[model samples]
Structures are given as C-alpha cells and as structure tokens.
Target: MIWQLDLILCLFIIICAIAAINVKDLLGAVIILGAYSFFMCLLWTEMGAVDVAFTEASVGAGVGTVLFIAAVSKTKRRSKD
Candidate 1:
C-alpha cells in the first residue's frame, strides 16, 4: 500500500518534470518546477524524512518559486518563441 502511494507520487513527479522541461513559456515552466518540488517534498515526507521535506517545501516551493516569479516579472519576457 505504501509502495503504491510512492509509485503514484513518483509518476506524478516524473510527469511534472517532463512538463517543466517541455514547456516553452518560462513562467509556466517555473510553475511546473514548483509543482515538481512540492511532489518531491511529499515523497520525502512519506519516506520518513520530515525535516528534509519541510526544507524542500519551504525553500523549493516557497521562496524559490517566489524568486523565480519575481525574476520573470521583472524581465517581462513571455516566451522564447
């Protein structure tokens, strides 16, 4: 049962990673990367690493995402294409 949950999380993480890389829009890719970080945090928590998970959640999904968004906003470049 726990393994099943882990498998599901891994699948979603993989999908998010692929989407983040494939996305042409910088903002969209950043958002997807945030989602990937969130899922990774979840996986870490599930694996009994609560401390690491919290760090990943706060830094990866929180401040990191905010910083990325701020940078993108300042640049105002929509997409490469």
Candidate 2:
C-alpha cells in the first residue's frame, strides 16, 4: 500500500513537472512548479526522510514558489520569442 502511494506521488510529480514546462502562462507554470515541489516533499516523507521532507516542503512549496511568482510578476506574462 505504501509503495503504491509513493508511486502515485512520483507520477503526480512528473505530471506537474511536464505541466509546468508546457503551460503557456508564466504564472500557471510557477503554480505547477509549486505543485511539483509539493509532490516531491510527499515522496521524501514516504521514503522516511522526514527532515528532508520538511525542508523540501518549506523551501520548495513555500519560499521557492513565492520567489518564482514574484519574479514572474515583475516581468511580462508572455514570452516574446
């Protein structure tokens, strides 16, 4: 059961990563990146790395997302090239 959950989380992380790259809008991509990080944190927890998972969850899902969004907001939403 636990292995199944881990596999699902890994798949979800991959999907989020693909979505982040394929999304047309910068904000949407950043949001998806955050989702990717969240899944990564889940994967870490499932693997029994609680400390690493906590850090990943805090930095990846929290500070990293905020920074990416702020950076995106400072620039144009669409790419010129």
Candidate 3:
C-alpha cells in the first residue's frame, strides 16, 4: 500500500471528524460524518479489506447518512439551549 495515500486518507478522516463535531448545523454535521465514513471506507479498501470497505460504504456512508438526514429533516435544525 502507498503510505502517502494512507496518510492523506487519514488526514481527510481527521478533518471530517473535527468538522462534523464542530459544525453548528445538524445537517452539515451529518454530511461531514458521512464524508468521514467514506474516507474510512477508502482507507479500509487500500489496506486490503474490500469486504469491510464495501460494508462501510453501504452502511456507514449510505444508510446511516440517509437515516440521519431523514431524522434531521423531521425535526428542528437547532436546539433551544
């Protein structure tokens, strides 16, 4: 595996993680979390875990994001606190 690719993917994952956590908007944070999952899927694929990568792509980046978005759309975007 190319170390540079792994490093870049890791950096992306970290950035997504931080961005998701720090974002004030619930929808934006969910989108960032989905991006983080995609990066994680890529990293797993690069490390020779195609099965895990596929699962992550389908579940983590796919259904999970959709579910979160659906839930978010059903409610208010911000909290009263």
For candidate 2, the C-alpha RMSD (Å) to the true structure equals 1.6
Each candidate: what lDDT? 0.93, 0.88, 0.93
Clashing pairs in 3: none
Q: Against the hidden true structure, what lDDT does model 3 obtain? A: 0.93
Model 3 ranges with Cα > 4 A deviation: 79-81
Q: Give the winner by TM-score.
A: 3
**After aligning candidate 2 to the native by TM-score, how far in Å is the CA of 2 from where it should be?**
2.3
The TM-score between candidate 2 and the true structure equals: 0.92
Ranking by TM-score: 3, 2, 1
Please provide, for model 1 over 1-81, each residue's C-alpha lDDT reduced to its tens digit, 9 standing for 90 to 100.
289989999999999999998888999999999999999999998999999999999988999999999999899746764
TM-score of 1: 0.91
Backbone clash count for every predicted candidate, in the order shown: 0, 0, 0
The alpha-carbon deviation from the true structure for residue 72 of candidate 1, after best TM-score superposition, in angstroms, is 0.9
Worst 10 residues of 3 by lDDT: 72-81
TM for candidate 3 is 0.93
Cα lDDT tens digits for candidate 2, 1-81: 298998899889889988889888889888899889888988998899999999999987999999988998998898532
Worst 10 residues of 1 by lDDT: 72-81
Q: Write down the TM-score of every candidate.
A: 0.91, 0.92, 0.93
1 or 2: which has the higher TM-score? 2
